[model samples]
Target chain A: MARLVEVDDAADPRLADYRDLRDVGLRRSLEAEHGLFLAEGEKVVRRAVEAGYPPRSFLMAPRWLDGLADVLATSDAPCFVVSESLAEEVTGFHVHRGALASLRRLPLPALDEVLREARTVVVLEDLVDHTNVGAVVRNAAALGVDAVLLAPRCADPLYRRAVKVAMGAVFAMPWTRLSDWYDALPSLSARGFTTVALSLAEDSEDLEAAVAGVDRLALVLGGEGHGLSERWTDTADRRARIAMSRGVEVGVDSLNAAAAAAVACYVARARSAGA
Target chain B: MARLVEVDDAADPRLADYRDLRDVGLRRSLEAEHGLFLAEGEKVVRRAVEAGYPPRSFLMAPRWLDGLADVLATSDAPCFVVSESLAEEVTGFHVHRGALASLRRLPLPALDEVLREARTVVVLEDLVDHTNVGAVVRNAAALGVDAVLLAPRCADPLYRRAVKVAMGAVFAMPWTRLSDWYDALPSLSARGFTTVALSLAEDSEDLEAAVAGVDRLALVLGGEGHGLSERWTDTADRRARIAMSRGVEVGVDSLNAAAAAAVACYVARARSAGA
Candidate 1:
């Protein structure tokens, strides 16, 4: 059972993993150095624990304890109860979600293992926003995409903001970063997967037509700003686009990365259902 | 033409419209009182201006004035140029986007006018997040939904965050808030439109089947929290759900409001294409 430890100091040493939540660079190095990430709120904390992530410790107000008693009962981690103000002071943001649990991030699964049994997958290239990463993972989980593979430069899906935005979907979805960026699409093709890049290239077919009846498919999406690198667009098995109405004069052109993922995955779902 | 007036003081009265942007409640009251909303960044500011919004004024860094000279040349509003630090002080947040414009809020179009030629429409019910509101609008615009109608309590699509996230699509899209909440869905059905509520009701049909070949359709979405109210679900012509994989045991049941809209709209687009 989790041992309850009462604490009041914002600078407490035991709460190191939970400090400076808003300082991205500091937290990134700290989390990497210590191999940790935070899962906030009762629901997300429960999900993290249920998904087999090891909890190092928890920091929250006293009232949030009872609601999470079952989760605490199963683990021996320390639960540090603090005043709401102290929690805010240490975290550098309002603890509106009410609880924060610092959990150990596991080593990422190998690319081959992640793709072993996956028939349908998503490959994200250089998405920099944590929220978009989380949302795409959540969309994949909901729409039955078998797995996700990220380009090495994509934002960490386990970042606190991503974890919170995804409502703990980063835990449920199977994902890994690709180390070999240069030949990633070709490698997938060699493994009997058809890599389809979501792009606006002239060679691109409409999304539905491109994705129809492909037994094994990898839908590759590009980064937020300039989209897929030219090399990737040239090398993929097929290029596809969600055709948009021409209102660019009134400011309608491309979908945001997360929205695009959702639309593409839904189309994949439709294709999977033979609709 | 907008006259460029340089100012050194952040506290100058001419910059009042650009003040305390991080304070949502204060900005809400202040913007409503002044009958204005802000559009941030160079692209969004240009869009707000081009979408037929009369500009009240603009506050930007000296470096930005040259880039926006074309837009300024087309407007009679004053452009108050200031230093970056001074811009930060007035905005209470980093003016990383380099420009801000206070534009007059145009009178909303009547509900009948918005639906007159909109074959595919999205109705939002009490969605409180500006980002979701904006993303849904952007998705609707891209995926060929003709318009968006909001409940009286839906967050303002013209709010700065929404405008920025929508990539200024809100200005191009036809949208208006429905004054009547209780009979809103029924009114759409009465106007010879299929009123479909995206819901988790037991009677809910799969989204694709529910929306197929309905000449004129309104897809109603609820708030982020509890989803569609029982009243609307009961009154709508049909309750439909995007079928999701059974990963709920791992905390992946519902898609967020924005993702759901993207998926639904993409399906709507495919149906429109006769795929």
Candidate 2:
């Protein structure tokens, strides 16, 4: 059974893992140094634990305890029961969901291990937004993409916001970072994967035509502002676009990166099914 | 040419339209009563202006004026120049984008008018999140969906955050609120459009199959938390789902509303092309 430690003081060092969550830089460095990530709310906490992430500790109000009793029973981690106000004071935001779990970070699987049996994959390049990263993961999971490969600059999928937004998909999906940003797509191509960069370069084919016949597929999506770099666009096996209606030129000429990934994943799934 | 009026005080009465922007209730009431909406950031403000949302005024740091000079020169609206700190003071948040525009809200198109030439339309049902509504609009616009119809309670697409996330697609797309939420889908059906509600109903056909052979398509999406209400799920001509990977039951069972809409729009667009 989990140890129920009642803590009244917001400044307790035991609550350190739960502090200053809104400070992105602090959380990033702190989480990185501690090899820990947080899952917020009851659903995400439950899902994270279920996905085999061992808990370092849990912080929550008394009311949330009853709802999460079953999950708590399975772990011996300390559960710090703080008052709602104290929880807010410590976390720098209202603990609206009333529960948060600080889970130990597992070593990321090797790129080869993740790609070993995968047929369809998404290779994200420089997607810096944490929410976008999580949303993309959720998209991949829903659409049945075999795995996800992150570029070196991609936002941490294990970041608290990403984890919360993903609803624990960051744990459920098979993914790993590419230490070598330059050769990421090239290596995938060498390994018999068709690396299709999602771009609107002149030579680009329509989305459907691009993924039509590929048995092994890897989609490369770039960051929000400028899109895929010229190098990646040139390096990839093919460059394709989710064809826009002609009138899109009026204001929105492009889909957001996460939305593009979702569309591309669906298209890839459809093509694979038909093939 | 626009008149440039320099202001030092954040409390100036003329700046009221740009005040307390972070307060949803305040923004809604202020915007609605004044028949105005705000567009933030250089790009979004530019797009809003280009889309012909006549500005009530433009508030910005002096640095932004030169970049938007050409756009400003074309209008006679007053441009209020304030320091960045003052901009933040009035907006109740850091105006990191350093530019904001309060524009007169044009009368929304009638429901029939929006649907008149639109073969592909999206009907949003009670989506309370501004960003989701904006994103769906962005997707619909990019994918060639003709228009968007919002349920009575759907968040205002012209709401500031929606405008910013959408990159001003809300201004680009033709959308109107449905006064009669319950009967909205049936009305679309009466007009010969196939109203496909994106739902996980057991009998729901795969999205591609649901849209196959259809000419006029209207996709109904639900809110962020609970999905489409029973009324919409039962009232539509057909219910459909984006097929998920079998393993998705481990965590997420569905896509976010905006992602779902994007996938559905892409599928609908493809079907329309094939037909």
Candidate 3:
């Protein structure tokens, strides 16, 4: 059973992990330094715990404790019980979700290990928005993608906003950063996975045709502003695109990163089933 | 040509349309009372103007003038030129996008007129998130959906955040609110369209299978929480669901509203093409 600590002070040093939750830059550095990430809401907190992420501590109001009682029973971490108002004061936002858990981030699994048993993968390159990163992860996981690979410059999937947007999918999805950005596509191609980059290149085929009959598939998506870096685009084994509406003057707009990823993942899943 | 008026005071009444944009409730009432909506950024402002929305006014720093010179040349609306600091003070956030425009809200087109030439339509029910509304609009437009219909209580697509996130796709996509939420689906079905609701109901077919071979399709999606309302679910012609990954215990997890909409729209578009 977890020890319940009633905390009345918003500025208490023990609640440091929960401070300034609204400041992205400050929270990013603080979380990185402490090697911890937060999971919010009753469901996300429970999912994180169930996924074997050891909770460093939990902050919640009296009402949230009971909902998370089963999760608390499995951990020895301290639970700081605070009033809702005081919890808001500490976190700089309404704790409407009721409960939050700070969990230690485990070191990422090796790339080969994650890919060994995987036949379908989603690779994201340089996505700066944490929300997009999370949504893509959620889409990939829900649509049966076996794993996710992120370029080093991609936003942190473990960020609070990402975690919240993904509904804690970061906990359920297998994801890790690629140490090598330059040769990432080439190496994946060499590993017998058909690396298909989602781009608007004139030569790119329809997304449906790109993944047809491929045994092992890797769908590569680029950042928000630019589709894919030239090196990655050129190096991939195939380039594919989701065709825009014909006869509509959409004028340079493409589907946002997460939307594109969802469509790509769904199509890939459907095609893979037939294969 | 636009009349350029230099303003030094943030509290000037002429800037009322650009004031306190960060407050949603206040802006909603104010914009509705004035029969106006805001478009932000140089591109959005240009798009809104080109899309035949008469500009009530423009607010921007001096540096943005040249980039938007062509757009201003065609409008007689006043351009309120201010320093970057004043723009921030008036809008309650950094106007990093370089420009903002207040445009007249033309009365929504009649349902029959919007549906006349439409083949694929996306219907949203009570979605409360401005970002999701914008993203869905963008996805629908990019993937070739002919129109979008919103329940009366859905978030405002013309809100500044939605417009910005959609990258101004709201101006390009033909959309309107459904006056009759109760019979909206049945009415579309009567018009020779298939009303497919995206739901997790046990009877829901796979999204691909549900939408296959439909001539005129209406993809009905629900709000962020609790999925579709019971009335909409029961009344829709059919219910379809995106398949969750097999063998993963993603307990009670579903894709976000926008991602789900994107996948559905893409599948509908692809199937429509084949048909």
Candidate 4:
């Protein structure tokens, strides 16, 4: 069981990990050095505990503690009970969700291991937006994609906003970050997975036709502004596009990359099921 | 050709339409009363103009006036060119996009008009988030859904954020608010359209199967937080769900309604093409 500690001071040194979250530099540096991520709201905190990413500590209003008693009973960390105003003052914003948990960041799984057992996986290339990253994970979880592989330059999936937007699916899905994207493609192919790049190029096969009869597949998605890199286009087994109807012009000529990722994943899953 | 005027004051009476936009209540009320919406950035503004949404007026920096000379030449409205600082002061933030246009909202086509000529359309139900609404429209445009029918409870498709997020698709796509959703369904059916509601119900058919061989179709999508209402569900000719793979627990049982709408649109288009 976790130890319940009562805190009345807004300036308590023990709450440093939970402070100044909106300051990018301070938060990013702390994440980089200490490898910690925040899970906000009661539901996500409960999910974190269930996922075994047990909280190191929790900060909540005294009135809200009873609601979390079941989750707290299973946690081995310190639970701090504070006044709502004091909690707000300490955290630099009104904690509207009533409770928050700080969890230790876990190292990503090995790419080879994730690929070995997966039939459908997503490879994200340089997707930097945290909201997009979160949404992609949410889609992945919903549509039954087995895992997510992040290429270099992708944002952290455990970022606070990402966690909130994903509704804690980041804790549930298997994900890994790869430093070398080119070297990663052949191994995926070696596992009998087709490395499909999503692009808007004319030479690309229609997405509906390309996804047929694949036993194992990796749908490679790109960043927001830039589509997949030329290197990826050349390396992928096939490049595919969603067919567009007449008089319908996507003003920017493509869907948001995260939106594209979700569509691609759904297509891949459907194709796999058909096979 | 539009006349360009130089303005130095942030508080200029002519700039009333563009002032204090960060205030949600004032902006919403203005949008509701005047049936006007703002489009930001050079790309969106240019698209809006090209799509024939006449600009009521424009607030711009001197740099944009020179760059968008061709587009500016076509509009009859007054174009106020101000310094970047003054533009920022009026907009309540840095005007990095350099130009903004306010457009008078036009009447949407009747439901029968949209359905009569359409092979594929999206019927949105209570999708209240402006960003999600914009995203759905962008996807509908890209994926070739012929029109968007906004239920009464849905967000204003012409709200500033919706227009910007949609990349100006609000101006490009054929959309209208449905005053009576239940009465309108029979009209849609009269036009040879099959109304398929995207739901997660037990008896729902797979999305792939639901869309197969349907020439004229209207996909009903609901808000992200709440799935389709019972009333909407009861009216649907068919209930369909995106297929998920085995052994993957979809921790979050739903996709972002916009994302779901995109996938549904893609599936419907693919099925129609296959038929």
Candidate 5:
């Protein structure tokens, strides 16, 4: 059973893991140095623990305790109970969902291990937005992509905002970061996966046509502003673009990164099923 | 040529259209009462002006003046010059893009006018998030969606955050609010458009299958939290769902409203092409 500690003071050092939750920069370094990540709200907190991320600690109000009793029962971590106002004071935002868990980070599996049983994969490069990162993971998982490969600079899936936006899909999807960003696509090609980079290149084939005959496939997406690095785009087995309707000259230059991922994943899944 | 007015005070009454822009509630009422909307950044400002939303005024630092000279040359609207600091003081947030334009909100086109030549339409109902609203418009435009119809209670597409997220696609896509929320879907059917509600109903066909043979397609999406209201779901011509991979039941319930819109629009676009 989890130990329940009633705390009136917000300055308790035990609550350090929950401090400055709104400070992305501070939280990033704090989380990295401590090898911990946070899951907010009751559902995501439960999912993280259920996914075998051992809890470093939990912070919540008394009202949330009864609802999360089952989640608390499975761990020996201390639950720092605070008033809702105090919780807000410590976290720098209203604890709207009322429950939060700080969980230990696990070492990501090697690329080979993740690829062993995977036939369809989504490869993301240099995507800096956490929400977009989370959205892609959710879309990839929903459309039956077996694994996700992140380029070295891709936003952290374990970030709290990403975790929330993903609705905890990050806990379920098999993914790992590529250490070798320079050779990521070429290496995937060598592993028998067709690395289809999503771009707007002149000779790029339509997404549906590009995925038609692929047996093992990896869909490569780039970061927000400037798309894939030229090196990665050039090395990919094939280049494909989502068909933007002709004559759309205005703000339709490109679909948002997450939107592109959804269309690409859905089309690839449909074509793969027929193949 | 546009009148150049250099104002040093952040509280200048004429700058009211650009004041407290970070406050959504205030901006909504202010924009509505004055028959105005705002576009920010150089590109979006340029596009909004070029799209013929007559400028009420322009707010920017002197540094932005030269680049936007052509746009300013096109309008007789007052140009307020302020330091970047004062711009932040007036807007309640750092105006990172450095240029803001307050544009006149012309009355939206009637439903019949928007639908006259549109073979593919996207209908949004009660989506509360501005970002999601913008994203859907961007996706719909990119995929050749002819028009977007919003239920009466849907978030305003002309809101600043939505405009920024849409990257000015809000100006490009033809859209208007449905006066009757209850009869919106049925009316589309009456106009010979097959209304496909994106839902998770038990008998909901796969999106691809649902859109396969439709001639005039209207893809309906719901709000962020609840999928769709019962009345809208039951009244639709057909219900369809983006297929989620079976056997993975952890966190993948449905796609984000915008992501779903992207996939649905892409599939419907492809199917319409074949049709």
Candidate 6:
């Protein structure tokens, strides 16, 4: 069972992990080194508990501590109950959700192992926006994508905003960061996976056609600005696009990377089901 | 041709409409009464110009003023070319896009008029987040949704953040707010439209089956907190759900409203194409 600790001091040394989160650069640096991520909201924290990401500690308004007593009973982490004003002062923002949990992030599964056990996976390249990254992970979990592999330059899925936006699905979904983009392509292909890059190129096949009957597929999505690099395009088995109607220019040549990821994930899941 | 003017002061009276935009509530109130909205970036401004929402005035960096020479040649509004620092001071932020256009909101087409000419439409009920609103508009445009009808509680489509997030599709798509929700249902049904409400109710039909061979379809999406309202569900010809894979606990009952909107739009478009 988790220990309940009453904290009145806003500058407790034990709560350093949850401090100054608004400074994203510093927070990300901390995450990269310590592998600790924060999950907010009662529901998300509950899920984290159920998923075996036993919290290291919790900060919450006194009102929520009783409500979360059931979930807190399962973990041995110390729970610090503070006044709402003090909680806000410590977190540097209005903590509307009333409860928060800080958990140590687990090391991601090896890409080869994930691919071997997966039928549907998403390969994200250089997607920088934290919200989009979170949304993509949430969609992946919802639509049955087995894993997500991030290439160099992708945003940290464990970032606090990403964790909140993803509703803790980032913790649930299998993900890893690969340092080498080009080298990972052929290894995935050699594992009986078809590497399909999503693009709007003239020679690209329709997204529907590309996902028709592939049992094992890796749907590759690029960043919001510049899409997949030339090396990725050259290595992909095919490039596909969602068919768009006329008189509908959304300024960009393609959908937001996360939106595109959802569509591609859906198509791949649908095709896999049919097969 | 647009009259080129140079402004050196941030407090210029002509720039009143572009001031204090970071205060969302105040800005919204101003937009409501004045019926004016701001568009950022050269691409969105160019689209606005082409769409004939003639700019009331432009606040631009010197470099952007030179880049948009062709577009400026046809407009009759004042184009204020200022130093980047002055532009930033006037706009209350660093104008990274280097240009902004204030446009008079054109009279919205009547709901009936949009319905009369449209084969597919999206009815958004109380979708309040500017980012989600923008994303839905972008998806609606790309997926061949002919129009978007907003309920009273829906956020203003022309809100600056929404316009920016949408990549300015708010200017391209025909949209208007509806005064009556219940009364509007019959008029749509009378026009040979199939009213499909996206929901996850037990009795709801599959989205794929619900949209098969539909001529004119009105997809109704509800707010993030609540799914479709009870009134909307009662009025809908069919309540539909996107099918999820077996054995996956979605944790949440439905996709994010914007994600759901995109899926619903794509399904309707695909069905219409097949028909």
Record all residue pairs in model 6 with backbone atoms less than 3 Å apart, i.e. clashing.
none
Compute the lDDT of residue B253 as modeled in candidate 1: 88
Candidate 4 residues B135-181, lDDT tens each?
89988888888889988889987887888778888787889889987
Off by over 4 Å in 3: A272-275, B272-275
A147-192, model 5: which lDDT tens digit per residue? Answer: 8899999999999999999899999899999999999999999999
The most accurate candidate by DockQ is: 2
Residue lDDT tens for model 6, A1-275: 78889988988888887888788888888767777888888988888778777588999988898788999888888998889898888788999999989988776777777766788899998899999898888887888888899997899887878877787787667789887777767767888888888876667898888988888898988898788888887788888888876533545445666777777887788884436
Clashes of 4: 0
Off by over 4 Å in 4: A190-192, A247-252, A272-275, B182-187, B246-250, B272-275
Cα distance off (Å), candidate 3, residue B15: 0.8
Write down the TM-score of every candidate.
0.97, 0.96, 0.97, 0.93, 0.98, 0.95
Which digits, one per residue and each the tens of the lDDT, describe model 1 over residues A1-275?
99999998877899998988999999999999999999999999999999999999988899999999999999999999999999999999899989899999888999889999988999999999998998889888888898999998999999998998888888878899999999999999999898889999999998889889888889999999799999889989999998887446556778888989888887776674323
Candidate 5: the clashing residue pairs are: none
lDDT of each: 0.89, 0.89, 0.90, 0.83, 0.91, 0.82
The model with the greatest lDDT is: 5
Q: How good is model 2 by TM-score? A: 0.96
Restricted to chain B, the TM-score per model reads 0.97, 0.96, 0.97, 0.94, 0.97, 0.93
* Residue pairs that clash (backbone atoms under 3 angstroms), model 3: none
CAPRI-wise, candidate 5 is: medium
In Å, residue B69's CA in model 4 sits off its true spot by 0.8
Model 4, position A93: C-alpha lDDT score = 88
Given candidate 6, what's the lDDT at residue B201?
Answer: 74
TM-score of 1: 0.97
What is candidate 3's lDDT per residue for B24-118, written digit by digit as tens? 99999999999999999999999999999999999999999999999999999999999999999999999888899999999999999999999
